[model samples]
Target: MSPQQKALLLPKKQGNFEIGSRSIPSPGAGALLVKIHSAALNPVDYKIKDLGFFVTDYPAVLGSDIAGIVEEVGEGVDNFRKGDRILAHGKFSNDFAAFQQYTLTDARFTAKASYEKIPSSESFDSAATVPLGLDTALVGLHGNHFGAGLTPPWTKSVGESKKPIVVIGGSSSVGLYAIQLARLSGFYPIITTASPSNEELVRKYGATHFFDRNLSGKEVKAAISKITDSAIGIVYDAISLPETQSVAWELLANDGTLVLTLPASVKEDEGKGRKVISTFAGPHDPQNEELCSSSWAVVEKWLSEGTIQPNKYEVLPNGLEGIIGGLERMKLGQVSGTKLVAHPQETQ
Candidate 1:
C-alpha cells in the first residue's frame, strides 16, 4: 500500500470539509511528486463546497496555489530535481490539487524558484500566492481566447504602451497582480479602486492612481478623467461582483475589453464593440495552455528581478484545520490585501 497523507476533503458536493487521509500518488512521465509545504486559500475552494461548482467528483480535494519541495522527478524532466524548492499551479484533480500533503505537478507549469535567479528571501508561503493570481492576471491580459490578447511583456522587443488601464478590486489577489502586469505592459497612470486603507498596498503593487472602492460609477469615471485623458481600453474586475462589474462597464471606453474573474454581470451595449472576457485561470485547459506555460516560464525571473511581487500573506494556524476558518473569513469579505497560507505538512 502507498503511504497515506493527511488531506482536507469535501466528501460530497455541497458537503462539509473534513480532515481525511489519502494515499500519496507517484509522479507520472513529465511530472514531479511534490511534498507540499504551503497551500494558499482561494475563494474558489470554499465556493466549491457551498456553491457545488467546478468539481464533479465526490471526496474532492480543492486548492490551486502550491509551493513545496520536489520529492521525485519523473521521466523526461531535467529542470527540477529532488529537494528543489518549487511552486506550481494546481488543478482541480485530487491528485494534482494543493490541499494534500503530497501532490503531482506537471513539469511544464512548475517554477523552480531555488535557481540562481530567484532570491533566497522568497518563502514557501510567498511563492504559494503567486501561481493562481499571477496566472489569472497573465491570462486575462495576454491570453488569446481567455484574455484581452495584449502582447505579453516576456516577449523580446515588447515596447511599453502608454494606454490607461483600470483594475477594480485592486487589493484582491488577482487585482493586485493585474495592477503589476499593467505597469509592466506600459500602461500609463494605471488606476485601481480599493479600500482607502489599502491604498499604500495597491500602490506598492504598481497602481499609479487609487480610488476608494465605495465611489459611484459616475464618481469613479469622473475621478479617472482628472488623472488621464487616455481612454480606458482595459478594465480588469478582479472582484467581479455585480456592483464592481457595473462600475467597470461604465468606466470602459467603447470597443474596450472588460476582464473578469467571474461571469459577466453587465450587458454589453450593442454596436459598442465592447468585449467581456471571463478568464479561467487553470493552465491545464487547452485554450490557456500555451499562454500560461509561457508566463510560467518567466515567473522565476520575474520574482527574482522584482518585476512581480507576491501578495502580502498571513499564515493560518493549526495547519490544515485552520483553512476552514480562513475560508469563512474570505466568504465574509473580512480578508483584505493579503493571501492566507496553510502549511499542509503540519497537518496532524
Candidate 2:
C-alpha cells in the first residue's frame, strides 16, 4: 500500500467534514509531490460544503491555499528539488487540493499551473494566506475574459494608470491584494472600503484612501467624489455579498468593470457599457492559465521585494481539526482582517 496521510474529507454533497486517511500521491511529469505544512481556509471551502458547487467528486478534499515542502520532483522538472519550501494554489481535484498532508503540484505553468518557493522572510502560515487571494485579484484585474483587461505590470512598458480604482472590503484577503496590484498598475488614490479599524492594515497594502465599510452606498460614493474626479473604471468587491455588490455597482462609472469573487447579485446595464465579471481564479482553469502563469513567474520576486505582501494570519489550534471551527467562525462573520491557517503535519 502507498504511504497514507491525514485529510479533511467531505464524504458527500452537503455532508459534514470529517478527518480521514488518503494515500499520499506521487508527483507526475512536470509536477512535484508536496508535504503540506500549512493550509489556509477560504470562504469557498465552507461554501462548497453548504452549496455544493465547484466540486463534483464524492468523498473529496477541499482547500486552495497551500504552503509546504517539496518531497519529490517529477520527470522533466528541474526548478524545485526535495526539501525546498514552496507555496502554490490548490485545485479542486483530490490529489491536488490543500486539505491533505500531501498534495501534488505542477512545477511551473509555462502551459500549466504553478508552484514556487516561499520567500525566506515569510512563515508557512503567512505564505499559505496568499495563493487564492492573490490569484483571485490578479485574474480579476488583468485577465481579459474575467477581469478588467488591464495590462499587467510585468509586461513591457505600458505606463502607470493615473486613474483611481475602488476595492470594496479592502481588509479582506482578495481586497488587500487588489489594493496592492492596483498600486502596482499605477492607479492613484487607490480607494478602498473596510472597517475603520482596518484602515491602517489596508493602507499598508497600498490603499491610498479608505472609507468605513459600514457606510451606505450613497454616503461612500459621496465621500469618494471628493478624492478623485477620475472615473472609477474598476471596482473589485472581494466580499461579493448582496450589500457589498450593491455598493460596488453604485460606485462604478460608465464603461467600468465590476469584478466579483462571487456571482453578481446586481445586474449590469448594457446601455452604459459597464460589465460585471465574476472571476474564477484557480490557475488550472483554461481561461486563467496564461495570465496566471505570467503572474506566478514573478511571485517569488514580488514576495521577496515586498512588492506584494501576504495577509496577516492567525494559526489555528489542533492542526487540521481546528479548521472546522475556523470555518464555522468564518460563516458567522466572526473572523475579520486575518486569515486562519492550519498546520496539517501537526494532525494527531
Candidate 3:
C-alpha cells in the first residue's frame, strides 16, 4: 500500500471526528484500495455518529458515500483495475468505508466512470452528487411495487393489477430522484410534498402535480387523493419520520405497499392485510454490489447526456480538519438543498 495516510477519524463513542494518521488500508483479497477525491455526508452519517445507529467498532471512519479513483487493486480484483474512476456507498462495516485518504471497496460496486459529456466545464462536486440518492431512489421505487415503465408490484401480467404510488418529500436527495423514477414507472400524478420554493423544481423532475403540505398528515392525504383522483396505490417515504407510515396508511389503496428507510409502525394500527415494507436498504454485501454498480452506470449515463443533473452540493473548505465544522452545519439543518462534500486530499 501507500504507507501511512490521514483519515477523518470518528471516535468509538458519540463525538466529533478528527483527522489522524493511520496505516494505509491494504485491499484484501477481493477488495480494491480507493484514493478518495471526495465524500458525501448523509443524514444517517450524523445520526450514525452522534446517535450511534449501526456500529460495530469505535473510532470508526464514518463516511459511507465516496467518489474517487482506484489507486490499487487487490489480488483477484478485476473489473476495476488501478486508475478507474468510481463511486460507492460505504460498505456497512467501517473497515470497508470511505472518508479517508483511502477506502477499502467491494470491486463489484465500483464501475468505469466519466461524467456525461457536458460543456466540459463542470467540477467534480457537481458530478459527485448522484450515486447515493440515485441508488436508494431506484431501490425504493422497485421495493414499493414500481419500476421504470412498468406497473408496480412484480406480477404475472398486465391483467394482474394496477396501483398508485405516492412519493412524500419529493424534493429531498432521495425524494428528488423518486419524482423522476415514479414518472418513469407511469405512476399518475406522482404526488409530492415540498415547500413552495421547490414545487416548480419537483414538478420538472416529473411530479404530475404538486402540493405544499408542510406537516399535516390530513393535508398530505387530501392532496394525494385529489391529484390521483382516487386513493394512492403505493406509498414511499424518503423522509425518515416515525409518523410518515401513518400518513401513508390513510391514503393507501387496498393492499398497497408502503416503503420507508425507517420502520413504519403499521402493525399496531390493526390493519393486518396492509403491507409494511421496511426498506432496510443500504450498501448490501456481495449480492447487491453488482446491481448497484450497473445501476450507477445507468444513472451516470443519464447525467452525462443531460437527462438528469446531479443534486446540489455545498463544497466545504479546509478538508480533513474542516469536517468537524461541516458536520455541525449539517446537524444544525443549515445545509439543506444540497449535500455536504469534502476533499481531504485538497486539505492535505
Candidate 4:
C-alpha cells in the first residue's frame, strides 16, 4: 500500500470539509511528486462546495495554489530535482490539487527560482500565493481565447503601450496581479478600485491610480479621467460582482475588452465593439494551455527580478483543519488584501 497523507476533503457535493486521509500519489511521466508545504485558499474553493460546481467526484480534494519541495521527479523532466523548492498551479483533479500533503504536478506548470536569482527573503508561504493569481491575470490579458488577446510581454521587441487599464477589486488576489502585469505591459496610469485602506498595498503592486471601491461607476470614471484621458480599452474586473461588472462596462471604451473572473452579468451592447470575456484560469484547458505554458516558463525569472510580487499572506493555524474556518471568512468577505495559507504538512 502507498503511504497515506492528510487531506482536506469534501465528501459530497455541497458538503462539509473534513480532515481525511488519502494515498500520496506518485509522479507520472513528465510530472513531479511534490511534498506540499503551503496551500493557499481562494474563493473558488468554497464556491465549489457551496455551489457544487467543477468537481464530479465525491470526497474531492480542492485547492489551486501550491508551494513545496520536489519529492521525486518523473521521466523526461530535467529542470527540477528532488529537494528543490517549487511552486505550481494545481488543477481540480485529486492527484494534482493542493489540499493534500503530497500532490502531483505537471512539469510545465512547476517553477523553482534558483537561490542566486530569487531574493533570500522569499518564503514558501509567499510563493504559494502566486500561481493561481498570476495565471489568471496572465491568461485574461494575453490568451487569444480565454483573454483579451493582447500581445504578451514575453515576446521580444514587443514595445510597451501607453494605453490605460482599470482593474476592479484591485486588492483581491487576482486583481493585484492584473495591476502589476498591466504595468509590465507598459500601460500608463494604471487605475484600480479597492478599499481606501488598501490603497498603499495596491499601489505597491503597480497601480498608478486608486479609487475607493465604494465609488459609483460615474464617480470612478470621473476620478480616472483626471489622471488619464486615454480611453480605458481594457478593464479586468477581478471581483466580477454585478455591481463591479456594471461599473467596468460603463467605463470601458468602444471596442474595449472587459475581462471578468466570474460569469458576465452585464449584457453587451449590440453593434458596440466592446467584448466581455469571462476567464477560466486553468492551464490545463486546451485554449489556455499554450499561453499559460509560456508564462509559467518565465515565472521564476519574474519572481527573482522583482518584476512580479507575491500577494501578502497570513498563515492559517491548525494545518488542514484551519482551512475550513478560512473558507468561511472568505465567504463572509472578511479577508482583504491578503491570501490565507495553510501548512498541510503540519496536519496531525
Please say which candidate is ahead in lDDT: 1 or 3: 1
- lDDT string for model 1 (319-348, tens) is 889999999999998999999999998887
What is candidate 1's TM-score against the reference?
0.97
**Every candidate's lDDT:** 0.92, 0.88, 0.67, 0.92
What shift in Å separates residue 84 of candidate 3 from its native position after superposition? 2.2
Alpha carbon deviation, residue 216, candidate 3 (Å): 2.3
lDDT of 1: 0.92
Off by over 4 Å in 1: 115-122
Q: How much is 67 displaced in model 2, in angstroms?
A: 0.6
Model 2: runs farther than 4 Å from truth? 109-122, 157-160
| lDDT, candidate 2, 1-348, per-residue tens | 999999999999999999999999988898989888889999999999999998999898999998888889899987788888788898999999999899998776311112244444446777898899999999999999888888898895545678989999999999999998888888888999999989999998999899999998899889999988888888999999999999999999989999999999999896989999999888988888888988988887787667788899999998889999999999999988999999998888
Residues 124-160, candidate 3: write the lDDT tens digits.
5565566667667776666323222233322222331
lDDT of 4 by residue, 1-348 (tens): 989999999999999999999999988899999999999999999999999999999899999999989999999999999999999999999999999899999999989944354344447888999999999999999999989998888885545577899999999999999998898888887899999999999999999889999989999998888888789999999999999999999899999999999999998779988999999999999998888888999999898888898999999999999999999999999999999999998998
Per-candidate RMSD, Å: 1.4, 2.6, 3.8, 1.4
TM agreement with the true structure for every prediction? 0.97, 0.95, 0.85, 0.97
| TM-score for candidate 3, residues paired by index | 0.85
* Clashes per model (N, Cα, C within 3 A): 0, 0, 9, 0
